[model samples]
Target: MAGIGPAPILFNEFFQMFMRCMPPNGWPVNSKIAVGNSGGPDSTCLLFLLQKLLTDLRSKTMARQSIPTSVVSLSVNHNLQEASHSMAARSAANAAAMGIEHLTLDIPWGTPPFSDKPVASQSMEQVAREARYHVIFDGMARTGAHSVAFGHHADDQVETSLMRLARGTTELGAGGMRRCRRWGMGTGDVEGGLGWVGHHGLDRWIIRPLLDVRKDRILATCEEHQLDYVNDPTNFQPEITLRNAIRQMLTLQEEGKDMVLSLLIITQSALSGLPQHISGSLEKIKVAAADLQETTMDLEGGLHQLHGAVKVLSSRLEDVDNEVTFHLKNLTLPSPPSTLILSSHALPAIVDPTVRLALVLRVMRYVSFHPWGSLRADGNRRRTSIQRIIDTLWQSDGAPPFTAGGGVLWQPAIFSAKKRLRVGTQCLGRRLQLGERFAWMASRLPAVPYNMLDTAILPSKLDIDVTERLASATSRGDDFLEVLFDCRFLVRFDLSQIPEELVEALRKSQETGVNVRIKPHTKYYWPKVVLRKPSCVDIAYATLMDNGQIDTFGHAPWVTMKYIRLLDAT
Candidate 1:
C-alpha cells in the first residue's frame, strides 16, 4: 500500500473534532436538528459540516435503523443593514445547495434599541442579538426542532471572559458559555405563557459544536470548501463596538504570544479548583441550614444561615444598594451565633447581633412563614400569586414589609379573620350551590385551570372584587374556592344535598359577615391577606390601597392567599 498525501484524503477535520466531543450518550439520534446560519464564515462552515455529518452518520449507523433524522437551517436577518436580507438569502441558498431544509427569519430593528451604543451612530449589536435569538427560537418551535446549534468559536470565548472581567461580574461569567446548559426563560417571564410554552426542556436541546475551534480554522475550512459567504459592513465599524475592539485586542495578543493557548490555560486554571471549593463548602454547612424557597437569607448573631441548595436571585443593585440578596427560606442555624456580616466586598463571617443584624437584613428578610414546602408540594401555585403581588408593590413604589423577632409584618389594611373565612366559605358554597354561575365565571377567566372551583378558596366580597379585577386586567381565568375549615370545629353538611337557592342565600349572609368583619378596621395601609393553594401551603403578601378605597396597587396575578393576619403594632 502506497502512502497517500493529506491533500487527497477527503477528511473533514472539523467534523471529526466535533464528533469526538459528543457525550457517551451520543447526539440525539431521533431529534429534528436546527442550525443557526448567519451567512458568515463560522456559521456557514457549521451548516455544511453538520449536514454532511448527519448524512454520513445516517448511512453508517446500523443501530439507528429505526431512528429518523430531519435537519433545518435557520438564518437570522438582524436588519442592521440593507445587506441583511441578502445575507439571509445567501444563507438560505447555501442550505438549499447542500440539499437541506432552510428558513429565513427577519427581526425588525428595535426602537431606541436596548444597547449601550446609540442606534443611528453605531452598531446595535446587543439588541440585534436578543432579537435574533427570539426569532430563532420561534422558528425552532414552528418546525418541531429539538435542538438549535450555533457556531461560537474559541476566540469568542476569550472575548466574553474579558468583557465580564471589565464589568466586575461574578467568576461564573468568566466561565464564558457552557458547552450545554438550559436556557433561561428570562426571569419571571418564564412563568408566563411566553415561557417555554411549546418547548420541551430535557428532550429539546441547544448545542455549540464549534466552541473549541478557532475562528481562523472555521474561515480556513470555508475557504478550502470554496463556500461563498456574505460580509456585514458594520463589523468593520471599529469605533462603535466592543467586539471590534476585542477582535483587535485578540489580534494584538496573537501577535504578542500564543493567545489561544494562554486563554485555555487561564480559563482552565480559574475553573479547575471550583468544584473542590463547592464540595468543601457543602460539607461544612449543616444540611438543613440553607433555605431554597424564599430567595431570602437570614442571620442572627454569629450564626450563619447557608442554603444547601443555591439560589441565584438578582435585583437592581440600586434597589438593594448594589448588593445581591438571597431569600433564605427555611434556613436554620448551622453553628453557634457569632457576629459576622456578608457584604458585597468581604467574605461571610460569624459575629455578634449588633454587627450581624444589618448584614442579615441586607441579605435575607426573615418572614414568619416558610412557604417553600407547601409551594413545592402544590406546584408553586401560591408562589405565582405572591410574585404577582410583589410585582404590583414594585410598580406602585410601595415599601416592602418590615420584620422583627416574631415575624415580618406589612403596614397594610387589616381585614378581620372572620370576614376572610366567611368569604372563603361563600366562594366554596357557590360551586356547591350555583353550578351554572360557577361555570360561567370560570369560562370568563383566562388562565384559570379546569376544576378550579374544586380546589380554590372563596374570598370575601372585597377579596372577590380584587380577584375579579386581576382576572379582567390580565385576562386570567377565574379562581376556585376551597375553604380550610377550622380543624378544631368540623361542621358536617352534605354539599350534594344543599339546594342551589339555599346555597345562594347562605352565601349572601356570609358576604354580610365578611363585610362587617372588614369594615371596622381602617387604620392599616393595606390588607393582610393569606393565600392558600394546593400548590402553596401558606404564603402572605400585602395588598396596598389608597384612602379612597380604590385598588391603588399591590395585587398579584400569580399567588393565592393562604391566610391574612392583623398586627397590633401600636
Candidate 2:
C-alpha cells in the first residue's frame, strides 16, 4: 500500500471534514453558482477541485441529483497597479481554457472625497473589500446565481479572530464569520434589519467552502495542478494595514518560536469550547431577563424588573470575571420598556454656541436616544432646571458630552405610554391590497384555487393603478383595504378597524394575542403573534412549492427550518 505525502493527505483530510459537515444533503442541486477567483493560489485550487468534483459526479449514475454546474469566475481588477488588468486577463484566459464561464470587472481605486486620506492610511483593506464584494455580488445577480462561493481558508479565519481580539470587539464580533447567512441586495441602510451594511441590491449568497482547509493545502493543490497565480504586492506592505502586520508576526512566530502549530492547537481548543460558553452565558442572561421584567436595565441605576413583576436584581461586577460581567452589564431587562433610558440633557451646556452645537451633535451620536426633547418635556420647573444647567455648562465651557454606547431618550409624552415607548422612527403597518384586476385574475386561475395563492404573490401581480391607490390611501388616510387569509380569503378591512377580528383569530388559533411593535417614525410594524401551529412549516412549504412542482425538494428527503429571533432594544 503506497502512502500519500503530507500535502495530499492534508487535502483529503480537509475534504473529508467538509463532506461530513456539509448540510448532509449534498450541494444545492439546481441553482446558478458563482465562484470568486482572484487569480490567487487559494481560489485557483478551489476552482480546480470544484470542476473535478462536478465532472466526476456527472459521470456517476447514482448522482442523478447532482447540480448542473456552470462555473463563472469573477475577477475584480482594483487598478491599484498597472499590472492588475493584465493579471485579470491571465485569469480570464485560464478560466476560458478550462471551458468555465469568466468575467473581469474593473473598479477605479480611490478614497471617497469625504475620506480623502490615502487608501493605506484610511483603512484601505476594509474599503477595498467593500468595493470587491460590491462587484462580486453585482456579477452574481447579473448571472442570476443563487450562491457565490469564496476561498477563505483556516488561516484567514485565524487572522480575522486575531484582528477582532486586537481591536477589543464584542464577543459577537470575535466569534468570527458564520458559515452561512442571508445577504440583502440594496445600497442604503436597510430600515429594519442589520448586518453587512451597504448596498442591498448587490447582495448575493456568499459561502466559504474552503474555510476548513488550511492555506498550505491550497498552495500545494495549486502546485499539483500547475496553476500560475499572481501574488498581491499590497500584502507585503507592512506599514499599512494590520493584516500585513499580523502576517509578519505569524512569519516571525513560525521562524523563531514554532508558534504556528501551537497557535493552531490553541485556536482549535478555543473553537471547541466556544459554543458551550456562548450557550451558558445566554441562558444566564435569559434567566436574569425573566427576573428583571425589562429587556434592559440601567447599569448605573442598579434596578431590575422581574417579568411583568418589577423586582430589584443586583450583583457586584467583582463577583464575576471582567469578560462575563461586561456582557451581563450590556444585557437589558427583557420585557416592556426594553431599552435602558438615560437622561443627559441636565448636563451643563457650553457657553460658546459653536462648542454647544458640537457637544449636542456628539451627544446625539453617542446616546442611543435623543436627550434634547427630554429637557423640554419636563414641566416648567423641571425645564427651567435643565435650562439652568445648560446655561452654566455653556458659561463654564464644561467638558464635552459624555460617551456611552447604548441608551434611550426620555420624553414626557413618549414615555407616558404603558406598553409602548417612543423611539426614533415608529413603523406603521401598511396593508397590502389586491386590486380589482388582481382579484379577478386570482379568482380565475387554472387548476390552482384562488385561495391557494400566497398573499406575497400579490406584489408581482399588482397593477400600477392598484399600487398608486394603495400608496395614496396609506399616505393620505388612516383607513385602507388589506387582504388577510385564514382557511379562505378574509375580506379587505382597515387594520385599526379590525382589532376585534384579529383578536378573535388569535383566540381561535389558541395562541397569545398579537402586538404591533413599532420602531419610531418608520412606516412598518412587525406583528408578533402566537399561532396555533408552528408557522415554519407553512412558510417553508409555501416557499418550496411556489418555485414549481417539487418532486423531492433537493437531496434531503425532509426539510428543517431554524428560527432565531433577536430582540430590538430601542
Candidate 3:
C-alpha cells in the first residue's frame, strides 16, 4: 500500500472512503459537518475533499429535494509556537477562499497544565492533541455539527501502529487508528469537568475518511486543485515529536526502505480488519445460544433465579423428589441497572487470545465508570491482567469477585446444586462445566467521588433553577440540570419538578440566613438501591435547608437517567 505512492484522490474513491467511515447511523440530510482544518496539506485537502463529496451527493440527490448539507472548517490554535496564530489565520483564509465557514479556538495558554513551566516536554505533543480534539468537539457541538472529520492519512496510520508496537500494545492497538470511532478519552486522561463543553457525555463521533489515502496523494490532490497549504516547521524536526521521528525514519534513504514501508502498511491493513471480523463472529455465537439461556442470559440474574428456585424446592419434601411436577410462583431475580453479563459458552470454539481479549474489552467498555481507566493502552501488561481474569473464568470452581479496568467489578456466577440433569428445577451447583455454562457479571464499581458536585451553597428555593452550566441543548430551555455520573450514566435532575413543600422550605431557609448545602443521598445509592427491569438507576439528592430540616428526593419521574457508551473498545 505504501509503494502505491502519491496520486490525486479521485472523487469516486474519496466518496467511497468517506462513506465507509460514516457512523452506523448515516449522516442525516441537511446536517453540518465540522472539519479539523489546521492549514496543513492533509487537513486543507480533507476540507476540500469533504466539501466536494457532500457537494456531489447533493447535486445528485439532495439538490433535487432542496435539502441543504453544510461543512465548516474548525481550527484549534494551541499557541505552542510563534506561528500558531498565523497558522490559524492562514487556515481561516484558505477556508474563506474555498467559500467555507471557518472558526478558530485559541487555547488558554495561561491555564494550569499549559502555564506550568517548561510546557514543551515529551508529553507536550500528546497534550496539544488532546486539547485540540477537546476544542474541536466543543466547537462541533456548539455549531450544530453531528460529527467532526479529521485528516489523518495512511502514513499517519502506519506511524501510529508502529508507535503502538514500540510501546508493546495489544493486537488491537497494533492495528492503528480506527477509521471511525466515538470521540473519547484524552490520550491518557478521562474527560471530566464542569463548564467544559467537550465532555458532554453523549455519543458523538470522529471520522477519519482519509485513513486509506497516503499523505503524498493528499498533497497531490491539493496541488491538482491549486489549494494552498503550509508545512509546520516543527513537523520536519524529528527531535520535536515522535510522529516526526517516525516519518523521518520511514523517509530515510535506505536500500530496503520501500520494501519495509510496504510491508508495514500491509501488516497494519490486515491487523485493522481483524477486530471487526472477530466481533462479528462473537455476535453470531451470542445469537445462536440465545435460546439456551446458557450464554445470552444475564449471569447473576440467572444464577440468582436458579438458586432461589432450588431453595424453594428444597423446602418442599414432595417437590424435592419430583422437581418437574411443580412450578414456583413469585420467584424472581433482577440484575443491576449498570451491569453487563457475559457467558463462557458464548465464546467461540477456538482459543484465540485476541478474540477473548476483544470480548473482555467489550464488556469492560459497557460497564466501566471512567473512560480514562480502560485497559486498551496498558500494552502487554494489560494482556496479562485480562488473561488472569480469563484464566480464572476457565477454572472449575470459578473465580472470586474481582475488579477490572474502567472501574468494573467482575463477579463469577456462584450456584449451589445437589444434583443435575433436570429441566427448570435442578439445584444449582457450584463449579459448573468450565467454558461451558459458566457466567461472569460486570457492573459499575460503586461510589465515584462526588467532587464534581457543587456543594458551595444551596439555592433559596429548591426549584428547577440549578446551575445552568450542566444544561444540555437538548433541554431546550427547560429548567434542568444534567450531569454525567461516573461517566457511565447520564443523570439529569429537573429542578422545575421539585416539590412545593421543599421549595417553600428552601425559600424560608434563604430568608433566615440558614447555611444550606445539597448533597448526595449516600444511603440510597448503589448496593442499597434495588435495580429491576428496564435497566436504569436512581440517583438521590438531599437538600440541607437548615440545621434540622432536610429534604430528600429521588430521581424517579422528573429526572431522566440512562446509560451512554462513552468508550467503544475499538
Candidate 3: the clashing residue pairs are: 416-428, 417-428, 417-429, 464-495, 464-496
TM-score on alpha carbons, each prediction: 0.45, 0.46, 0.69
Top TM-score prediction, candidate number: 3
Displacement of residue 35 (Cα, Å) in model 3 is: 0.9
lDDT of 2 by residue, 363-394 (tens): 22222221111211111113233333335333
Better model by lDDT: candidate 2 vs candidate 3: 3
Q: Residue-wise lDDT of candidate 1 within 199-298, one digit each (tens)?
A: 1332345677776666667777787789888776766543445554445434534555454443333234422332332223222221222322323322
180 in model 1: Cα distance from truth in Å? Answer: 1.4
Cα error, candidate 1, residue 395 (Å): 36
- Candidate 1 matches the true fold with a TM-score of 0.45
Ranking by lDDT: 3, 1, 2
Assess each prediction's global lDDT (C-alpha) against the native.
Answer: 0.41, 0.40, 0.54
Best by lDDT: 3
lDDT-superior candidate, 1 or 3? 3
Regions of model 2 farther than 4 Å from truth: 1-5, 9-29, 61-68, 109-118, 184-203, 257-570
Lowest lDDT 10-mer window, candidate 3?
A: 324-333
